[model samples]
Target: MLKAQQSTEMERLLMAWILLQNFDVQVSRFVDLISFLMADCRYQQMMKWIGNIHETLSQLFIDASPLDHTTCRMAL
Candidate 1:
């Protein structure tokens, strides 16, 4: 039989950071929060968190770059 998997603290933190944006979190705070998540020893969760961060930043840049958000204030 297969056992159910549980989330580690790092994964939980990453999930929380992802959800925080829905609650109107500041972008800089969200980036800072990722640093806390990266401290965990769980390799898989850490990689997932890295991917999530990369994806989010990539999309934000994609939107901001075309909109002339060089100051980044309007995009965020």
Candidate 2:
């Protein structure tokens, strides 16, 4: 009976160790996925900001063109 109890305990300990290893791997993968997602999110935000700046600059140039043409005409 004592040997049986020891065997059972050993099995339980082995199972616990396997579970802990698997849990560690799962946690590591989860952290890597989160880091990749965060980097991708930051990249998306930066692209969006760059797009907004480009649009603003384009609009400014569009708005200034007529004024530039009128000034050139007046000067001539």
Candidate 3:
């Protein structure tokens, strides 16, 4: 999206909120997939890719909550 145009503040915020709302189930499924793939020949490389995805998701949560810092500070 950034390549075409920057998101409006509201759009970005909404994106983050949506991402967070679904993240619990999303990450759980990702973990299961990763575990299932662990015996593959590419296991080590797959772990690194999954780790990067996780970091990106974490950043999304951060980006979403900065405007209302207190909201993000609460335990998820």
Candidate 4:
């Protein structure tokens, strides 16, 4: 499923990093996913993608944004 994201290209990876930031969830699950992806042999080909994921996570922690963000709303 993730194979199609096969690119270290910075521009695309940057966009992906931003999206990941806005949607980050459980820390363990997120880290586990990135760790698994990093261990793959094909990973070197997509280093930027994986690296940006890590970078986004790092920035999230460093930014010190307050929790309790805008409340969720459901209407469907």
Candidate 5:
């Protein structure tokens, strides 16, 4: 049951990231989602998934266009 709840929260966080235009909020929301997921004892085994998302976010900044580079880096 707890796993289901955490999964839902994580989904909501990702949706919030996608729907929201503010990069700062997206990063913060993801971080909070990761923190919450980490708090779950059973999900500690899934830490790699959280790490992957963080890595993806980092890559997203690097892949962004030059004009958005400063904006993305500043948000990170």
Candidate 6:
């Protein structure tokens, strides 16, 4: 009977270890996914800022007179 009890305990311990390993893998995957999403979000925000700057510059060029354009070119 004692041997049977020991065997059962060993089985339970093995099962628990396996479950913990699986949990660790799942947590690692979740962390990786979150990191990828955060990077993508940052990339999208940078693109939006670039678009806004381009639009503003386009408008500036359109509205500027010839003298202003000459001045701008010289400044550049």
What TM-score against the true fold does each predicted structure earn? 0.42, 0.31, 0.33, 0.43, 0.38, 0.33
Report how far off residue 43 is in candidate 1 (Å): 1.7
- Looking at model 1, which ten-residue stretch has the lowest summed lDDT? 1-10
Candidate 2 total steric clashes: 0
Q: Which candidate gets the maximum TM-score versus the true structure?
A: 4
Q: Score each candidate by Cα lDDT.
A: 0.55, 0.43, 0.47, 0.51, 0.59, 0.45
Clashes of each: 0, 0, 0, 0, 0, 0
Report the C-alpha lDDT of model 2 over 1-76, residue by residue, as the tens digit: 9778667545644543453344333433433433433344334764465455335434543554533544322332
Off by over 4 Å in 3: 1-42, 66-76
- The digit string of per-residue lDDT tens for model 6 on 1-76 reads 9778667545644543453344333433433433433344324764465455445444544565534554334432
| Clashing residue pairs found in predicted model 1 | none
Error of 2 at 3 (Å): 58
Per-residue accuracy of model 5 over 1-76 as CA lDDT, tens digit each: 9779888867755664563345545455555655665554255546666666656665675677634646565655
lDDT of 3 at 68: 50
TM-score of 1: 0.42
Write the residue-wise lDDT of candidate 1 on 14-43 in tens digits: 575565545345555555556555554357
lDDT of 3 by residue, 1-76 (tens): 7433333433543544465565444544544443443333233664576556556545555566435534434544
RMSD of 6: 24.4
Candidate 6's C-alpha runs over 4 A off are 1-42, 69-76
TM-score of model 5 relative to the true fold?
A: 0.38
* Poorest lDDT segment (10 consecutive residues) of candidate 5: 19-28
TM-score of predicted model 2? 0.31
Better of 2 and 5 by TM-score: 5
Query: What lDDT does model 2 reach?
Result: 0.43
